[model samples]
Every structure is written in structure tokens, then in C-alpha cells.
Target: MPRFAANLSMLYNEHGFLDRFAAAARDGFKAVEFLFPYAFAPAELAARLQDNGLRQVLFNAPPGDWDGGERGIACIPGREAEFRDGFLRALEYAQALDCPRIHVMAGLAPVGRRREELKATYMENLGWAARQAAKAGRSVLLEPINTRDMPGFFLNFQEEAHRIVEDIGAKNLLVQMDLYHCQIMEGDLAARIRKYLPTGRVGHFQIAGVPGRFEPDVGEVNYAYLFGVIDEAAAQCGWDGWIGCEYKPRRGAVPYGTGEGLGWLRSPVLPGV
Candidate 1:
């Protein structure tokens, strides 16, 4: 069976951010991931993780002016200094939190900007970030988000992300494959998983229902079959990574709706249930 991590940003919304840790732990998740941790002190977040016995599997680096709609600055020319500073700050948080991976969002491609220019900047920044992360015994992740949900996201395909990782030749730089986005942009989920898992380029995964972005079970994608594929591929590739439950609760934030919607986790399709 695959280990699961609750995305506190989307799940457990019934409670405050801090309180969501305990709620996730109470519902049987041993690991967790969130969008960002800059809002709270590192020490405070660390205490929450320790108290709940949950591992911090992942979190994203600072995307420039999040409230003002900048998805990231890594690919935006002239923001190199800002991107480096933000990444270093994220690294400090990752080290303090004992988190192994930090996702570096490829900024939205600027309108009218040359693709080659943006690509050059993105690869350069990723290479630098990967080198920095290597020194700390940590890995940097790049996720290909669907343009539908995040219009203008710079990275939008698995092959494109893998190509960046390959071109950079940084072992510490890897891809974060979100199945939800994969289904949106491409349909061969199983084939893609089998193809990438053993290549050792994929470092993490996120899942949600199609159309609604709800719990995995509610989606048109057959998570049960996909989970089985993951188990087989993992056995062959020796990949033991966490699958982040990054989805909204269909039942809404009605106290235990998130927990209640976790029937898929308890199904016989997954082992150790």
C-alpha cells in the first residue's frame, strides 16, 4: 500500500491551520503537506509536527506576491535575486522542519515573453536551487500544474518537467507528479506512472477527483486501479514516496467531512487497511 499525506491546505478546513495537524493525525494520516509555512514560526510548526507524530512530506517555496497573483518568480526574468532569496528562506524552513523535499513552483510564463527566454531562466534557477538543496541532503521538486486550474503556469507537462530535470543533470532535482493535473492535460495515468517511477525522476504525487477536485474516490479516474499500478511499480522501482491527498472535501467543511470522505483510504483495494 502507498503511504498517504493529507494536504492541510485543502483538507481539514473545518479547523484552523494549526488545529488541522491534529485533525489529520486523528484521522490516521502519518504524514502531511501544505502550500506554505511562512505564516507561522518554524518552531511552532515543528512543535505541531512532533506533537502529532506526522511527517512534513512537502511544501512549496515562496511564489512572488501570492496575493497579487504571481504564481512564482523562478521563470520570470529580472526576478532572479528575489527568487534566490525566497528559495533560501524556504530551505531554512525545510531544514528546521526536517522536511526532505521543497517544491519550486515554475512561475507563470509572462505574456508576450519569448518561451526560450523563460525556459532559460527556469532551468538556470532550478539548477541553482538543486545544487543548494544538495548541500543540505534535501531534494527540490518541480510539479507540472494544469493550465486549466492555474492558467499560464510555466510548467504544464510531465515530459517538459522531466526534460528540465535531465537538462540540468541535477540528481537532487526531481518531478512532483500530480495525478489530477495529469488527467486534465493527459489521460494515460497508468502508463505515465509506470514509465516515470522506475526512471527515478518522480519524487512525489498529489491526487484529486476530476472536474470537482474532490476526494480521489469521487473522480472519474479509477484511483483503485491506479493505486494498484503504483504498488506494482513501487515494488519494481523501490520507490517509497508519499501520495499527497491534495483535494477539497466534497462534503464541505462540516467538522468531520474531510475525515468522513476518506472511505477510499479504508477500502480493501489498498493494503493494511
Candidate 2:
């Protein structure tokens, strides 16, 4: 069975950020992930994890000026220094928290700048980041976000991300295959999963209902079937990675809504659960 990680950033908004860790553990989740952890001290976050018996599976590197709408600075020219500093900070947290992977968001593509220039910057930064992460025994992940949710995002397709991973030639560099984004940008989810999972380049997976970012069971996508596909494919390749429950609850922020939305996790769709 595939391991599932609660995405605390979205799943338990009804609780205080720190309190969400206990909420997730109460709901039988063994692992958790979030967008950013820079707001809290690493020691405090680690304590929460230790207390709840939860593992910190993933989190993002600092996205430049998230309030200013700069998703990431790694792709922008002249921000290499800032990007490196942010990644190092992220690595420090990763070490303190004992997390293994960090996702680096590819910033939105600017209209006036050449695509080639942005891509060159992205590759160079990733290459450097990968080398640094490798020394720390952690992996760096690149995810392809759909344009609808994040318009003009530099990375959008699975093939493109895998290609970049291959070109960068970093063993510690891997793709974060988010099924929601993949379904939005490309329809053949099973084919993509089969093709990519076996290559050992996929480090993580995420899911949500399509047409709406709600629980997986609410969408048109057949997550049960896809889950089975993930199991079969992963077993063949020995790819054991957590699938992050990265979706909004259908019940909004009401108490226990996130836990209630977890009925899908108890169903027969996920064998051996």
C-alpha cells in the first residue's frame, strides 16, 4: 500500500498551525507535509512531530516574497544568491527535522524575458541545489504545476520535469508527481505513472479532486484505480514514497471536516490499508 501524508497546510486549517500536527496524528496519518515551515522554529516543529509520532515527509524551499506573489526566485535571473541562501536555510530545517526531500517551486515565467533565459537559470540553480542536497543525503524535487492554478508557471509537464532531471544528471534530483496537476495538464495518468515510477526519478506524489481542489473521492478522476496503478507500478520498481493528501476539504474549515473527508482512506479502494 502507498503511504499517505497529511498536507497540514491545507488539511487542518481549522486548527492552529502547530496544533494541526496532533489533529493529523489523531486521524491515523503517519506522516505530514506542508507548503513552508519557515514561520515556526525548527525545534518547535520537530517537537510536534515527535510528540505526534508523525514524520515530516516534505516541504518547500523558500518561495521568494510569497506575499508579493513571487512563487520562486530560482528561475529568475540575478536572484541566484537569494535562492541559494533560501535553499540553505531550508536544508538546515530539513536536517533539524530529519526530512528527506525538499520541493523547489519553479517561478512563474515572466512575459518579457526569454524562456531560454529563465530555463537556463532554473537548470543552473537546480544543478547547484542538487549538489548541495546530495552532500546532506537529501533529495531535491521539481514539480510541474498546472497553469490554471499557477498561470505561467515555468514547469508544467511530466516529460519536461523528467527531462530536466536527466539533463541535470543529479542522482538526488527527482520529480514530485502531483496527480492533480498531472491530470489537469495531461490526461493519461496511469500511463504517466507507469512510465515514470519505474525510472526511480519520482520522489513523491500528491492528490486532490480535479475540477475542484477537494477530497480525492469528490473528483471525476478515479483515484481508486490510480491508487491501484501506483501500487502495482511502485512494487515493480521498488519505489516506496509517500503520496501527500494535498487537497481542500469539502466540508470547509469546520472541526473534524478534514478527518471526515478521510473516508476514502478507509475504503477498499486502497488495498492493505
Candidate 3:
């Protein structure tokens, strides 16, 4: 089975941001990832990781003016300079946390910008970011968020994400395939993984229950079998990365002995050592 990491941003929201590290560690997660880390000091975050014996596996580049409704700035036509700055800031945090993967959010397309032009800008920014990350020995990841959840998001389809990676021709750039988003957009989860995994183009993977983004145990997707597929495909291709559990644990989604919605990590269904 593939190694799994918890997405602290969505998983441990019951606790404060800093407190989530300890919470994750207490719940048996050895690695974690989050949407963004610009709010806290990298040194402090690193200290928490060290104290909890958890590895910071991944985090996103700063989303532009998040409160002002910006998901990312990479796809905006005139935000090239802002994109570069945001990437540098994220790189600083990643280095401090010993994180090797950074997912670049393709922000919403500007209201009247030509689609072709915006795509060009997106390609340019991604290529530039890839080269910079390569120099630092890190990989840049791109994810295809479903349009239903994040309307106007520039990168919305798995095919488009793969195309962008090919167009940029950057060896350090790869796709961050989020399983929840894939189920929301398309249904052939196992086939997609088998197709992408063999090419060594998938950098990382994420999971959440489908239909409501709840516990994977009761979702439309058969995570247990799917985990087997992911493991088999990655083993065949020699891919090394964590499958992050990014889901919301509602109050009564499933039975829990420890008062946490971790059905996916339980024995019989979860991967074994």
C-alpha cells in the first residue's frame, strides 16, 4: 500500500492551526500537508514538526489575497511578478520545513481576459516556477480542481494539467492528482491512476470521500480497492510519494473509537506495513 499523509488543513480543523500538528501526530499520522503556510513563521512550523516527529510533506504556494477572493495568481494575465514573489516565499517555507513538494494553484482567470492569453501566461509562470524549484532540488506540482467546487479555476481537468506539464517540458513539474476532485469531475478513478501512474507523471495523490467530501469509508469510491490499485500502479512504475487524506470528518459519518473520523485508516480497510 502507498504511504498516507493527513491534510491538516481539512482534517484537523477542530483544533487551532498550530495545534493540529500535535493532533495529527496523536492520531498516528507520520506526515502531513496543508493548503498554505504563509500565516505562521516557517521556523515555528518546523519546530512543531520536529516536536511531534511529523514530516511536512507538502504545502501550496501562497494564494493571492485569499480574503479578497483570490485562489491563486499564477493564471492571471498580469500577475507574473506577483506569482514569482509568491513562489519564492513558499520556497523559503518549504526549505525550512524540509518539504520537497509545492503545489502551485492556478488562480481564477481574469474576468475578460482572452482564454488563449491567460493560458499562455499560465504556461510561462509554471515553466519559470519549475526551473526555480528544480534548482532547489524540489518538485513543482499542478492539480486539476473540479469546476463545480472552484468555478473559474484555470486548471480544472486532468488532461489539461498533463498537457501543461508537457508543454512546459519541465522535468521537475508533475501533477498533484486529488482523488476527491477527480471523482467530482470524472468517474474512472482507477483507470486514470493506472494511465497516469505508469508514465511517472503523477507527483502526489490525495483522497476524500466522494458525494460530500466526507469519510472515504462510506463514499461512492471504494477506497480499499482503489488503494490497492494505486499501490499496484505505483509499484509498477516506481513512484514514491504520499497519498494525502484530505477530507472533512463530520460528527456522525462513521463509527469512531477515538472521536475522530478516521475510518479510512482503520485495519482491514487501511494498508498494512
Candidate 4:
């Protein structure tokens, strides 16, 4: 079994964001990850993790204007400065929380732009972020979001993402493989996991149901089997990082609370380590 992390941004929605830290720890989660930490003070989030005894595994670098439909700013060509500034801000938070990874969203590529230029800008931004993270003793992750979810999402295919990771050529920069999006954009989950295992390039991992983005147990992806695959991948890669439970809880008559849908993840990663 893999070590699991509660994605406070997704799981534990029954409580406020700050309170989710405690809720996760109460439910036997040893670690936590989230989408953004910009809304609260880094010191406050750090305090919550300390109080709850949870490790901050991962979070995304700032995406530009999330409310205005911009998924990220890194690949947006002219937003290089903004992207760097956002990365620095996120790094500050990561440092405070003792987080090890930051997901850099590639942003939605506008239809009329030059694809080459877009890729260049994204690579430049990620290279810079990777260098900074390396200096901070952290890693940078780039996730390939499915086009179905965001329409114009810049990074969509596994091959493309792999190519970008190689092209960037930074040891601290790797793929944040989200099983839900990978199943949507590409279907060879096991093969891909094994292929990347040799390089140990997968920096972080997330899971959700394929068609509905809900609990993994309810998905087209056989999470039970896939969980085994994940373990193999991690073993081969020598990875002991968090497997983030990034999904919606299966709704019941009452709202989903902490641990309501965790029967699928019964295996303990260790005997309390």
C-alpha cells in the first residue's frame, strides 16, 4: 500500500480550509496537500500542520486569475515576470509549510498563438522555477491537465509532458502524474508508470475517479489494481513521497466528512512508520 495524503482542497471540504488540516490528521492521514495557500498566512498554515502533525506534501504554484478562467500564467508568453513572481511567492509558502513539491500549471494556450513560442515560454518559466526550487531543497512538478476539463489546457498528453520534462532538463523538475487526467488524455496507466519509474521522474502523484473525478474506488481506473501499480512504481523509483487523495467524496444523504469514504484505502503504509 502507498502512503496517502489528504488533499485539503478536495477532501475534507466539510470543514473550512484551515480546519481541514486538523480534520485530515484526525482521520489518520499523515500528510496533506492542497491547490493553493495564498488565501491564508503561511505561518498560520504551518502552525496548523504542526498542531495536527501532518506533512505538507505538495501544492500548485500560483495560477493567474483563477476566478477569471485563467488556469495558469506560465505559458502565457508575456506573463514571464508575473509567473516568476508568483513562483517566488508560492516558494515562500512552501518553505514555511515544509512542503517539498510545487505543481506549476502550464496555463491554457490561446488558439491563435505560436505553439513554439508558447512551449518556449513555458520551458523558460519552469526552468527558472526548477532552479529556484532546487536551491530551496524542493522539487517542481508539471501536471498534464486534460483538455476536456479546461478546454485549452497547455499540457495534455503524457508524451508531451515527458518531452517537456526532458527538454527542461532539470533534476528538480518532474511530472506530477494525476491518474484522473492521465486516464482521460492517455490510457496506458501501468505502462506509463513503469516507464517513468526508471528515471524516477514522477515527483508527485494524485488520484480520482476517471469519468466523474470522485473517489478512486468508484472510477473506471481499477484503483485496487492501480494502487498496486503505484506501489511498484514507487518501489522501482525509490519514492517515498505522498500519494495525494485528490478527489471528491462520494456524496451520501448527509455531506461527506473526514474519513467517510476512506474504506478503499484500508492498507496502512507502515506500522506508524
RMSD of each: 1.8, 1.6, 2.6, 3.0
Per-candidate Cα lDDT values, in order, are 0.93, 0.94, 0.86, 0.86
Model 2, residue 231: what's the lDDT? 95
Per-model clash counts, in order, read 0, 0, 0, 0
Candidate 4 weakest ten by summed lDDT: 264-273
lDDT of 3 by residue, 110-227 (tens): 8888989988888999999999998888999999998888898888789889988987889889999999999888879889988888887799999888888887787688888888
lDDT of 2 by residue, 96-122 (tens): 999999999989887899999999999
Minimum summed lDDT over a 10-residue window in model 3 is located at: 251-260
RMSD of 2: 1.6
Per-residue lDDT for 1-273 in model 4, tens only? Answer: 888899988987777788888888887899999999999999999999999999999999999999999999889888989999999999899899999999999999988999999999999999999999999999999999988988989899877888889988999988888889999999888888778756778887789988998888876888777767778767766887778999988762245564777877764232211
Candidate 4 has an lDDT of: 0.86
Model 3 residue 154 CA deviation (Å) reads 1.0
- Comparing 1 and 2 by lDDT, which wins? 2
Off by over 4 Å in 4: 252-255, 267-273
Candidate 3 or 2, higher TM-score: 2
lDDT of 3 at 191: 92
lDDT, residue 118, model 4: 95
